[model samples]
Target: MDFLERIKARKSCLKACETTVTTVSGHSYMEKILADGTSVISWPQASTSPGYVIDTKPDLQVAHVLPGLCMGSQDVAHDFGLLKNHSVTHILSLGVKPVTLDQMLNYTYVQLLDLPETNLISSLDQCFIFIDNARQSGGCVFVHCNAGISRSASVVIAYLMRKESMNYQQALMHLKNIRPVIKPNPGFVQQLKDYEKMIFTLDGK
Candidate 1:
């Protein structure tokens, strides 16, 4: 099926979310994060197609990590229309295989052979460089893997750690606060822990 058709079908089958997504003609909702670090979603009286969800149980889509960075599943990576709408300028793939989507024609693409059990510590620097360069250039980047949970999340966390000088726990908490579905594998988790020590020592932090 075409991308638009797939989106329509998915919307038709939408279920209840914590914010209670509705499709009533003219019904509206907005999501906001409060100053107390809590999020609340409320729907008012307005009308349009149901809003897109960043993360849904059993269903997957891209999630914004920062203003110029995002993480998502391979499905989101393939949806060229979505990427175009978001003005994504770069696509970083953490899967073993390269991205072969026709929709990626206009985007700079990078594929890294990052498996769940692979040694991510060695590759973290290269991944960070790619994402950092895009952000510095005022371009947006979307990183993805097969499931958008492990490999991609690891790369994002590593980037945050390097750029923000955050420890692993702090970075993980910040990511979960927004995406809420990132869970790196045990092996990756260990690597991230070791990485924290390595980077800290190098910088004398």
Candidate 2:
């Protein structure tokens, strides 16, 4: 199915995220900081139909209400018309593959990492490598998936837990703040709890 269709079908499943996502190259960049001290950004693509040029400059930030889940365009993500000043190096894709739709044409950031689907165990694995790479690079990490809901949030949550040492609730709050639309599947959430419990058991917590 088309990317737009996928978003329309799952809009209700996403939660309310109040964080600001900047639209630079037509793509959306939802920014957040994880417990690991690694800078986390969610590239939800915002929407399909592109609209007005919001902001441009030394301090550019945007608050958007998304109608769907599919990504915007990479042209918009790399449009530098507004992002010329900032430097993007790390990219984290929660989706099995990047570029869901015919969006990200030629735009390329610096480094890209892909994680498996969202679940307690998979999330932990995804973050182990994701955070390590982010620390090694000292650059920002951009993460996205089909819809940026479950898969992206789960992995990012794990990163928050490990790096920032935030508890599950605390980490989840950060995710919601950034992408008010992020609602991990109930099963996904349970899995994370299980994973957390497992860690506590192993660590004698």
Candidate 3:
């Protein structure tokens, strides 16, 4: 199946699945049983309420997309030590719950879902302002989502395309060179292409 077909299949599968919330040792976990009898378990970060489980560790990996701009997973954003080490003073959180860290750091939270149908372009202007403000103030900005794969990667690519005057393909290629795991969903890719045209029109190029 092609990309759109795959997306449709996945969406149908998701719609057909049954989901349940269960608490284990105060941590809430979401369990989904697909139509095909495949079970999937996920830790719902927002279910933890005021804060998340600090003990649940994820691999500490961050990729520098630009001089002062970096991209990583939600875990890297929550890690105080990692933020300090990277000198990340601003955070652009996409589709993930905000973690309370320090008063010195700034955060811009966008309620984005990591679904292909989600409109990522509408959030780009706000995100770009946050990133630009951080860069102007000589502070580093770390952009992240759940897995640092789709949502966050698309944001970074959009930033590069807008600020650097690079096309979608060029920006995507540059980011892929730095972070090979970067892969924006098909819907996001189409939106980015639309954004490029919008930019060109505004620039009279």
Q: Estimate each model's TM-score.
A: 0.64, 0.49, 0.71
Q: State which candidate, 2 or 3, has the greater TM-score.
A: 3
Stretches of candidate 1 off by over 4 Å are 1-60, 96-116
Best by TM-score: 3
Evaluate residue 174 in candidate 2 and report its C-alpha lDDT on the 0 to 100 scale. 70
- Name the TM-score of candidate 1: 0.64
Candidate 2 ranges with C-alpha deviation above 4 Å: 1-86, 99-120
Per-residue CA lDDT of model 3 for 150-196, tens digit only, reads: 99999999999999999999999999998888899989999999999
Name the regions of candidate 3 deviating beyond 4 angstroms.
Answer: 1-57
Inter-residue clash pairs, candidate 1: 26-46, 26-47
Q: Per-residue CA lDDT of candidate 1, range 1-205, in tens?
A: 9999897776666543444455545466776655443568886777655455445454346688888898877777767778778778888777545455664333444454445577887777777778878888888988887787788888899888888899999989988887787889888998899888987999998
- The order of the candidates by lDDT, greatest first, is 3, 1, 2
Q: Scored by CA lDDT, what does every candidate get?
A: 0.75, 0.50, 0.87
Give the least accurate 10-residue stretch of model 2, judged by summed lDDT. Answer: 62-71
